[model samples]
Every structure is written in structure tokens, then in C-alpha cells.
Target chain A: MATFIDGFLWYFALAVFVIGVSGNLVTIILASRKVDLSVPRDSAFSGALRTLFSRFLPDQHMLSRIGIQVVAGYMFHLGLFILLFFAAPHVAFLEENILGFGWTAAPHWLFIVASQFAFLGIIMLWLYRMTNSVSRLISKLDDHVATILTFLVMLSGCLALLESFETLRLLHRFLVELLLIYFPFSRLMHAFTFVPSRLFTGAWFGRRGVDS
Target chain B: MSERLERGLSKLRSQIDPKVKSFFSSCVHCGICAESCLFFTETRDPRYTPIYKTEPLRKVWQQEYTFWGKLASKLGIAAPIAEQDLADWEELVYDGCSMCGRCSMVCPMGIDIAQIIFKVKTGLSAAGFSPPDLAETTQRAVDIGSPMGVKLPALQAQIGHIEEEINLKIPVDVEGSEYMALLSSMEIMYFPEYISALAKIFHQAGVSWTLCSDAFEATNSGLQIGNTEVAGVLVERIVAGAEKLKVKNVISPECGHAYTAIRWEGPNFIGRPYSFKVVHILELLDELLQSGRLKTTGKESSRLTFHDPCSIVRRGGVETQPRHILNAIAENAVEMTEHGAMNWCCGGGGGVSGNERAEPLKLKVFNRKKSQLEELDVETIVTSCSNCRLVIEDGLEANDMEINIVGLTEMLADHLVVDNSQ
Candidate 1:
């Protein structure tokens, strides 16, 4: 059981993660070819680049209106980013198994704080989605599935943090594998696709001389 | 099984470009666009959420475009899109939305919610589910050369009246003029003062401009109805008129959607650039003011605020021009809480005013503007779009608010410094 979990399933998940993400990206890029023939009032590339970064900072006027979502979204995304790349176990796992190189990991206390933030944020967002009328109306089966699966993965990973129980670690690994397989097909693709999505909209607004 | 349903589905299929795909993929049902929409804010109905309004288009995208959706359909599990779906969405797409683009502005993923909803409107139109009043207006626009049925004789009558009132010649079809001006049917019928105002301002500025006798109507109901074929026909009339008169520039009248249809979307609709340039009347007036051609005196004593029309300021990129004109003429030109490009819509844009069925809903949503005005406590409201003026007048009357609404051009004309040299 240990051998299959550590070797075959691990490699399978990694392969699917890599290939599925790239395949989905290539498909999206080739899906349409829209040539705008109108005269542009501004540079499309500059507008795209500006929006790619500008969206990270909410507009001052909108901050009060969307304060809760903005704060919770940042906490979840930033904490998850740190836990994924900078936590000691994740850094060790990548260096030993995938990259053959290493960077210094976050301190043990910081890792604990990050996971707590991630858990708090994800729970808040999921609860808000269930409660809010607009969100409830638009939420699909896929959205709930993605949120629940992400929560289970994070919960299992926290249980496995002690590194003493093989079952806990394998549970985390299996759930992550499922998430990997589901990522490209689900709205989780927003993580990488947001750049190009914003670029398309920004270019359109740029041609019309409006800031996106 | 219906032909309209088939045409609608085909159009929806064609509208699913890469941007639509990306927008759908990036949206996570966050529901942030709800707070930005006045309809949802006023009604508290989840159905009015801007993103939820795109459900039909999104369903079409999922069923036909996505991998899992395609597989589910192949297995006979996914629900097929039916005629009822399009029929139900007609009210939501036409009556419940003003296309203010506030949702587009607030979307964190940078999705142009308004543009996507426009594609949905195209589908609804093709499915023959447009509001009856808007459809009738579009038909009249196609058949009578103007949506309000204002013909050359009527305009000539108004021109004769304005010429007599202002003591200035209103040029018509004058060859070799520097600019060819177009008027909205509203300006011609309800507010002939706009014509006299333009004559007064143009004469003071010494600019050679003429109205096209053949294509004086600037508003395109095709754009409002989301019918490209009819929109192209309206734009072509202006193009033909401009070419015939050999004008260097064409000034779009102070109507919101007319400016958008003529100045921005006209070239693309007609599939070619124009020999003459298109400029909004506000843009031309602002330019003349900056260049010292147009001058104004005697500030308006009443405290006033400018209502930025959605299509003119937000969608047309003429945000600063109206403010420039207003600040120059009004002694106390205040601003609303959310002014300029982000101002709340007057709830009558996107042909809502033309649709009689939407009047009640439009008035309900005008609570947004009501609160904005209440906050400012201005004596009068000035706007550039005639549609906004009329709609706000209706809204103010329905709510029993005692606010006077004026067009920016007429207001500016009242303050024009008559040159003694002339």
C-alpha cells in the first residue's frame, strides 16, 4: 500500500497535473480568433499589462462595498500560495521528489499560521456562497464540489503535518490527486487563466480609450 | 422546432468567442456584480444579478462547448436549451437591465458583463422576444427614416421655426461644409431648442457646419434592439449623406446611444472607415472652448449637478468634456457621490424608455439616482443625453421630486457670449 501511494499514485497525479493544465491552456488559446479591425485609441499590450497587476489592488471606491470578499479572498489565496510553495514539508517534498533543488522554507510557526488563515478564509467564503442570494443562484454543482474538495485536502494536510501517521498523509495525497485531475476541468482554472481573461477585456476597453 | 429558436441558438453559438469562454471559466459565482447593479439593489431579486442574467448564454456555452457538458449531452443527461428559456429571459434582458455597465466596471475578473449581456440581447432579438415597443420603434426606424417618425418635412418645419427664433441660418445639405451635424428624433420633435442652441453656439464659434437633409436622424434603434443588420442600415444612411455633402467631420448630436451607434460602432457595422470623422457635439464644443472659438459668460445662479449619461460618458470616453463645459458655465456645479465614468445610470438607457412595459421597473431603479440627488441637494440636474433628460423628468415627476432637468447644450447656449463683431 505504501509503495503504491508513494510511487505510482504520486507520479500519476503529477503527470495529470502537468499535462491536463497545459492541454486546457492550449485549447483555450486556440478556441477563437477575433481580429478587431477598428482603430485603437490606446496600446492593447500596455492596457493588458496594467490590468493584470491593477486588479490585485481593489479600487478605493469599491473597497468599502466588497471589503469582506476582498479580505477573505486575499487571505485564502495568499495563504494557500505560501503553504503550497514555502511550507517546510512542501519545499522538502519538491526538492527531494520533483525539482532536485531547494529554497529555505517558512518557519514552523509561520506554516501553522498560514494554514489557519487558509482554513478560516475558505470556510468564510463557502459559508457566504451558501448564504448569499446571488451566489446561491449562480452556484453550480461544480462550484460546491471544488470548494468541498479543497477543504478536505487542506484538512487532511493539516492532520498529516505531524508526519507520524501514514494514513493521514496518504489521505491528503489521494485528495490532492483528485483535485489535480479536477483542476483543469473546473473553475479552479481561474488561477492561471485570469491573466489572459483580463488581457482580452483590457484590450477591448483599451481600443475604446476606456480604462478597464 | 421553431425557426426563431433555431436562429437564436445559432446566433448564441456564434457569439461564444474566446472572451466569453474565458469569462465563464473565470467566474466563480462570487456574486460581487450584484451590488453594482441598481436593479438587483432595488429589487433584491437574485434573478437580477448581472451574471445571473447571462444564464441562458452560459448554459448554451456549457452544453455545446465544454467537455463534460458535451459528454453529458452525448449520454442524454444534460438538459437541452428550449424556446421557453429564451422567452423567459426576454423581460430580464430588456426590461430589467439598462446596460449601465456598472457590473462590467466592478467585475474583478475583468469580464465585460455589459458586452456579454449584449450578445445575449442579440440572441433574444433573433428569437423574436424583444419588447413590443422597442420592436415597433426599430421597425419605424427602418421604415420611416427615424424611430419617432420624424421626417425631413418635420425637421424642415422645426428648422424654419428655429431659424426664425435665433435669427441665424440653419444650413442643410450645404456642400463643402467643414462638419455635417445629425440630430436625434427627440431633439427634433420635443426639444427644438437644441437646434437653436447649436446654431447660436456654431455661429459664435464661426464653425462651418450643416445638417444632412437625407440622414438627420442620429439615433439607431437597431443598436438598441441588438440587430446588426438594421444598425448597419442606419449607419449607412449617415455615411451616404456625409459622402454626398463632402463634409470633413460629422458631429453626433447630444444623445447618448446615438453617439455610441454613430461615432463608435458605425464604422465596424458598415465594415469600413468613414471618409469624414465622427465627433460628439460635446466633444466639438469642448474643443472650440479650449481653442478660444467658443466663449461663455454669466454663471448659472442655481446649484446644479451633471448627470453623466451611460453611453456618452462611460461607454463613449467623453467623461471630461461635459464637466469642462458645465464648470465653465455654472457657478456651483457640484458632483454626485459616484460621478463621471462610474455614475449611476438614469434607468432609461439601452432602449428601456422606448419600452413602455419597463417604465415602472425603470422608475423603481431610479431610486439610485434619487438618493444620489438627495445627497447633493442640487436645485437642477443637467445632462447631455435627451433620453436621460426625458427619463429623469418622468422619474422625478413619478416620485414628486421638484428638480428641474436641463440639457447641457441648451444650458450652455443660455450663457453664450454673443460676439459684437458678428
Candidate 2:
């Protein structure tokens, strides 16, 4: 039964990842091609390196506590990135099928840390959506839906990771599979949307004689 | 001191049409808006951020209109949308925002924050929050047919006056002209050189154009009064005048917002399709340059820099043509750090320059642009917006700085070497 559950979650996750990754990659590639770099490239190697490093640092400028929602945003993102790269099943799949360069999977203790951070982030965000007038103003039906899905996924991931109970693990794997199928259609696709969108923005702002 | 504060609000709430109220119902506060605001950037005040500035209306929307707001309303938990609420937040809604779509550029949800603010202003105007000058202008536009209150014969006299000054046949209702020349209140009342330039260019290019004396003013109060009805009426007179003459295209002078009002908003407001194409005078000049119909002597001695007016550049999308013209006409056209679409606003936009309550606010805002000018160290600044020209002129005077503010036509007119030898 345990083996069957793992098989189901992995297959669904793989299918969704493949479609989401391809769709977003095509969008990014098309957008990049359409963007004109003909404006004399003022780009420096130093700026590229700094941009790469800055992603790791906190985006402190827009980070005033006013983005009380944004802090939750950062948390969900950070946790999702960690879990995507370092989860044991994901690592094994990446090594065998995709990268052919596998590393040791995160241990139970590490999943515990990731779960706490991801859950706390999701909760803070949920609280914000409920409390803040501004957040309430801008939020759509999908935002709350995404939050509920994330909460379920994080809650289930922890239960499954702890090997807490057989029934609980099945429940977690079932919900996780459901989300993998849903990810492509939802705002969860911001993961894919933001890449070329940022590049498109950078190119346009540069052309308009603006500082991005 | 006696308690003389009116403390009471106006009766505009019941007057607002409900379609606009639906617009106020739509803003969600993701606040991708903060970085897009000039006021937020300048003052560094969180309250000035477009999202924050729009809170009062957003609260009313959330409380009265939305699903959750309905729930809050039923429970008596949410505050009612009150007179004092609209009255208290008037400045925050109108004066705080310049209605620039910079915030809309960054909006992930594609919400037009500026449009929402304008709609809120409309609601406030219905709620009796309009400034006296705006009300006066609307009344003047309705009665005298111009925001500037120029009587029609008086306008024709001004036209005759400019024709004499320029030594050209300035035609009024000249039969079957190629273009219908529209004069903004800025040019008709104050800057005659621009009107003269129009005459000189039309004569030189050999393009037939005539101004209408019937409804001479181009300052549409719709943009100022937060109502499109007056704008519609003003636009109809102009559009009808164009149709009456049977012209090919309409040409707007160097007023930036007025250009947008005529070129873009005119078509949108008037509903029926226009037979004549609407155009900015800069684009007309660019067409003249492209066709080799008009050429500048390329003779200006002052080292110049171009400031892209938000009206012409961002709103009108005529940024390139003006800069192209400026570079062609000037010997040394150096760029200020922020030029083109991202250029800092001259702080005179959104009818704020003419608003008496916002006059002090305009100076504070113009300081940002003034400082940018100081940094560039250019002697002459050429811009395309008329209101920008007025505000920047007021700003320079207030700050005791000496910088020449030349309109595109004024600069173009100066470069014209009329053939006296012929």
C-alpha cells in the first residue's frame, strides 16, 4: 500500500512538472526572443553576478513590515524551493531521469525544519488575507484557494515525512497528487510567469530611459 | 477664534452614477503600487502610496459591496460609507494621486489604479468634494464654451491679434482646409508664439488648416471636473466644427494633457467613429520632417535638453517624435538622467497646477523635477506639455532659477527661416 501511494504521487508530480516546466519555458523563450537587446548592451558581468547573489539575500527594499503579506510570500517561496530541490523522492527522480547527478536527500529532521517554516509562512499569509484591508481588496478567489491548497500540501507533507501513520500518509499523498494536477492551471504558475515577465520588464524599462 | 470650519460635506454622493461606483468596488490592495508612485517615492510616506491613498474608498467597497463586505454590513461590523469619510479623504484621493499609470505597469492583477483613483474623484465630486476653481471652470466651459472663460469674439480678436504678429495669413474657418487646427486655452490666452508657429508651419508646409471660432477652447473640463459629460459637450463642439469644415485631420497644439484629451480621450468619449484622424502637433511636425516638407534651420544657440511630458510621452505615446525633432533642430541635445517615458513629471499634471488648494502641493512636487533639471545643468529645456510648461515656469520663478521653457512649436517656429528674399 505504501509503495503504491509513493508510485501514484511521483507519477502525478512528474507529469505536472513536465507540463508546467515546458509551458513556462516556452513562454520565457518566446518572450526573450521578442525582447530587443539591440539597445547597446550596457550590461556588466558584475551586475549579473550581483543579481544572482541578491536573490539569496532578503529583498530588503520592498520588505518594510507593510508587506506583512510579502514576508509570508517569501517564506512560501523559500520553502517551496527547498522542498522542490531537496526532497528525497524528487532528488532520486532528478538524478535518474533529468540531471543524472543525484545528491543525498534531506533527512527527516531537515523536512521537519522545512515543514515548520512553510507552515508558519502559510499561516501568516492566511491571517494577513483575513485581517488586512488592503490585502482583502486585492485578493481574488484564486489567492485564497491557493493558500488553502498550500496549507493542505504542507500539512500532509509533514505527516507523510514523519511516517506518522498509514492512513495519514495516504491522505497526504492523495492531496499532493491532486495539487500536482492542479498546479498548471492556477496562479501557482507565477513560478513560470515571473521569469520572462521580469526580463521583459527589464528590457522595456532600459529602453524607456528608466531605472528598474 | 470662532469655529468657522464648514465641518459639513457636500451633496454629491447621491449624484454619482453607479457604473463608476462599480469601479471603486474593484481595487484589491496588492500594493504593487508603492514603487510606481512619485509622491510615495518623494515623500517616502506610506500613506501616499497609491494603494494606501485609495484606502478610504476600498474600505467602503469592502464594507458595502463585496461578498465579505456584505457580510460585514449585515453584522454591523463594518463602518458605513459616510459623508465625513468622503469629505475627510478628499485630498488623499485627488491631490495625492497624479493619475499616472506607473502603478498600473507593475500591477500583477492588471488593475488600473489611476483609473480607480479618478473614478473615486468622480464619486467625491458627486459627493461635493470638487474644488471651487474646478467648479468655476466647469461652469465657464458650459456658459462661455472654454475652461479659461474666453468669450468667442474675444477669442477671434486674439486670433486676429496673433495673425498680425506672425505676418502670415492665419485663416479662420478657411474653406476646405486639410487640417482643423485646435488651440488649447494655454496658447489662446497666454502663449501666442505657439499659435504663430502653427501659422508659420502650415504656410511653409503648404498644408491648409483653419481654427474654429465657434468653440475655440481645447481645455476639456471633463478631465478636471471628474465628469465626462462636459468633456463630451466640449468634444462635440470641436468634433462638429471639424465635420463642418470637412477637414482630413485635427491638430492639437503644445498642450500635453489637452493633446491626450483630444487625440485619445476624444474618440473614446464621443462614441461614434470620427471621419477625421486626431493628431498631436509634434507628430504633425515629425510627419513634416519625415516628408521633407518642413526643415528647421538647426540654428538654436542655447545648449538644450528635452523633457518628455507625461501627457505627450506616456499618455499620448509621442515620445520618440519630439526627441527626434529636438535632436534634429538643436546643435547640442544632451539628455537629462531621466528622459522619455520614465522622466519625472513636472508636478503640474492632473489639473493640479490650476487647483488653488493644490498650488502649494505643486511646488513641493515640482522640486523633484527642478532638482533633476539642476543635475543636468542644461540652459534651455524643451517640453511638450502646456500645463507642465506653466507649472515648471511657476516652479522656476518660485525657486528663483533661470531656465528657458520652450514649447515644441516655439522652438520649431524659432528655427523657421522664412524666405524674405523671394
Candidate 3:
């Protein structure tokens, strides 16, 4: 059971994630886009690049209105990023199974802190989604599924942190595999799609010489 | 599905290009766009949320483009879009949204919400679910060469009146002129002063300009109605007129969407680059001022403020020109709490002004502007777009707030240091 969960299921999930994401991206790239013939006031390339990073900081006027989401979004994304790449277990696993790399991992204390931030951020975001009328009205079943699935994966990984119990580690691996497969199919695609989305819009506003 | 629903869905599916796909995929329904939208903020109704307004198009994208959606549709598990769905979204896209692009600016994910809303409008328009008044107006534009049905005779009459008053020749169909000026129906019927002002300013600046007898109307009801074919036709008329007149530049009048239709979206609509450059009237004034041709004598002493027309300032990228011109002529020019690219709409853009059904709601949303004005306590509001000026005038009257609205060109002309030599 451990071998099946750790080896074949893991490979299967990774394949699905890779194929699904690539296929969706290719589909998007191949879709017909209207060619703009107007004389551009500014460079579209620079606009796209500027917007790619500029959107990381919320607009000052919007900061007060979306303070909670901004804070929680940063917490969740940064915390998850730290845990995914810098955590000891994740690094070790990636080195053995994927990247053929064994970079220095963050200390155990940092992992705990990062996990707590991720947990708090995700929880707050979900609660806000449920409570805020606009969010509640707009959020779909996909959002809830993605959030709960991510939470379970994170929770299982934390429970298996000590690696003292075989069952907990397997459960964590199973959830991780499930999440990998679900990532491309769900709103989790935002992690990758946000780049091109920003680029397209940035180029548009950039061509118009507006700081969007 | 009925034929109308099928046609609407097909049109929507066609609109689901790379940008739409990317935007939809990136959205996590965080609802941050809601805060940026005036309709949602003023009404506190979730239905007015910018992202929420894209439901019809989003649903089409999902059912047609996504993996699970395709599977569900094949399995008959997903609910297909119906005619009533398109019918329901008419008000949200047409009335609730001014297409001011404010939500587009504030979106954290960088989604062009206004662009998508425009695409959604195309689908609704194809489905024949648009406002009756806007549809009638578009028909008038198609039949009479003007949205308000302002014929060439009427424009010629207005021109004769302006020429008599200004004691100058208002050039009409003068071949090989340097600039061909286009006027909105509102400018001709409601504010002929814009024509007189243009004549005075152009004469003082020694700029050769003419009005195209064939394509004098700049306000595009097709753009407002979300029918690109009609929009393309309108743009082609201007292109043909400019080409025939052999003008080097086409000046868009002091109307918001007209500038958007002619300057920004014109070439795209006609599927080619323009033979001549398109310039907003404000841009020309600013240029003339910088070159020391157009000089102003004195400033208005009243506590005045410059209302940035959304299309001209934000969407059109003529933000600084109006301010430059205003500062040159006004003694006291205050800005709204939120101005420039982030300025609130006059609650009547994107064809909302012509939609009689949207009047009450338009007046209701004017509170956003009313409060902005009340906060500043400004006596006069000067704007570049005639549509915005009219809407603001209506808004002020509805609230019974005694504030005056003036066009930037007319205001600038009032202060022009008339070149006696010319």
C-alpha cells in the first residue's frame, strides 16, 4: 500500500498535473486573439512586464477597501511558497523524486511559523468568502473544493512532520498526490494563469499609456 | 435552447479568446473588484459586482472551454445558458456598468473587467436583449448618419449660426485641410458653443481645419450598442471622409465615447491603420498652448473643478492635457477626492445616457458624484465630454444641488487671448 501510494499514485498525479496545465496553456495560446491595428501610445511589452510585478502591491486607493484580502492573500501565498520550496521534508522529497536537488532547508521553527501563517491565512480567507456578501455571491463550488483540499493537504503534512508514524506520512502523501492532480483542474490554476492574465491587461493599459 | 439563446451563446463563445480565457482562469472570486465598482459600492448589491456581471460570458467559457465543464455538458449535468440569462444580464451590463474601466484598474489579478463586460454586451446585443432606447438610437445612427438623428442640414444650420456669431468661416469639406473635425450630435444640438470655440482657437493658432460634410457625427451608437459591425461602419464613414478630404488629422470632439470610438477603437474596428492621425480636441489645445500659439488672457475666479471624463482621461490616456489647459485658464481648479484614471463616472457612460430605462438608476448612482462634489464645495464643474457634462447637469438637478457644469473647450475659448491679426 505504501509503495502504491508513494510511487505509482505520485507519478500518476504528477503526470496529470503536467499534462493538464500544459494542455490548458496551449489551448489558451492557440485561441484566436484580435489583432490591434491602432497606433500605440506606449510599448505593450513594457506594460506587461510592469504590470506583472506592479500588481504584487495593491493600489493605494484600493488598500483600505481590500485590506483583509491583501493581507491574507500575501500570508497564504508567501507562507505556502516558503513551505513548498524551503521546508526540509519538501526539499528532501523533491531531491529524491523530482529535481535531483538537495538544497538547504529552513529550520524546523521556521516551518512551524510558515505553516501557522498559511493556516491562518487560508482560514481567514475562507471565512471572509463565506461571510462577505460579494464573495459569497461570486464564489463557486470550485473555490470551496480547492480551499478545503489545500487545507487537508497542509494539515496532513503538518501531522506527519515528525515522520514517527508510517500511516500519517502515507496519508500526507495521498493528499499531496490528490492535490497535485486537482491543481490544474481547479482555480489553483491561478498560480500559473495570473501571469499571462496580468500581461494581457498590462499590455492593453500600457498601450494606452495608463498606469493600470 | 431557442435560436436567440443559441446565437447569443455562439457569439459569446466566439468572444472567448485568449484574454477572456486568461482573465476567467485567473479570477478566484476574491471580490476585490466589487470595492472598485461604483454600482456595487453605492448599491451594496452583490449583483453589481464587476466580476459578477461577467456571469453570462464566464458560464459560456466554462461550459465550452473547461475540462470538467465539457464533461458535465456532455453528460447533461451542467445547466446550459438560456435566453432568459442573457435577458437578465442586460441591465447589469448596460445600466449598472458605465464601462468606465475603474474596476479594470483596481483588479488585483489584472483582469480587464470593462473589456470583458463590453464583450458580454456584444453577446447580449446579438441576442437582441439590449435596451429599446439604445437599439432605437443605434437604428437612427445607421439610418441618419447620427445617433440623435442630427442630419447634415442640422449641422450645416448650426455651423451657419456659429459662423455668423464668430464672424469667421467655419470650413466645411475643404479638401486638403490639415485637420478634419468630427462633432457629436450632443455638441451640435446641445452645445454649439464647442464649434465656435474650436473655430476661434484654430483660427488664433493658425491651424487649418474642416468639418466633413459626410461623416460629421462622431458619437458612435454602434459602440454604445455593442454591435461592432455598426461600429466598424461608423468608423469607415469617418475614414472615408478623412481620406476623401485628404486631411492629415481627424479631431475627435468633446464627447467621451466618440473619442474612444474614433481615436482608440476606430482603426481596430475598421481592421486597419488610419491614413491620418486621430487627436482629441483637448490634446490639440494642450499642444497649441505649449507651442505658444493659443494664449489665454485671464482666469475664472469661481471655485471650479475639472471633471475628468472616463473615456478621455482613463481609457483614452488624455489625462494631463485637460489639467494643463484648465490650470492655464482657471484661477481655482480643485480635484475630486478620486480623480484622473480612478475618477468616478458621471453615472452615464457606455450608452447608459441614451438608455431611458436606466435614467432612475443612473440618477441613483449619481450620489457617488454628488458626494464627491459636495465634499469639495466647488461652484463649477468643467469637463471635456459633452455626454459627461449633460449627465452631470442632470445629476445635479436631480439632487437639487446648484452647481454649474461647463465644457473644457468652451471654458478655454472664453479665456482665449484673441489674435486680432487673424
Select the stronger candidate by DockQ from 2 and 3. 3
Task: Return the TM-score for each candidate structure.
Answer: 0.97, 0.72, 0.98
Candidate 3 clash pair list = none
**RMSD after CA superposition, every candidate:** 1.6, 9.5, 1.2
Across B101-205, the per-residue lDDT of candidate 1 in tens digits comes to 888877888888898898899998988989999999999999999999999999999999888877899999899999999999999999899999999999999
Leading candidate by DockQ: 3
Give one digit per residue, the lDDT tens place, for model 2 in A1-212.
76766786668687886776566455335432322212222343333233323333333433464466567666776887777688886698689867989998888677667767777877887787777554555566656776788788777766666665878867877777777776655556555544333343343333333333
* Per-residue error (Å), model 3, residue B250: 0.4
What shift in Å separates residue B97 of candidate 3 from its native position after superposition?
0.7
Q: Give per-residue lDDT, candidate 3, residue B340.
A: 96
Error of 1 at A127 (Å): 0.6
Report every candidate's CA lDDT: 0.88, 0.67, 0.91
Candidate 2 is graded, for docking, as incorrect
Error of 3 at B152 (Å): 1.0
What are the runs in model 2 whose C-alpha is more than 4 Å off? A1-212, B1-30, B60-65
The sequence of per-residue lDDT tens digits that candidate 3 reaches over residues B350-387 is: 99999998999899888899989999999999999999
Candidate ranking (TM-score, best to worst): 3, 1, 2
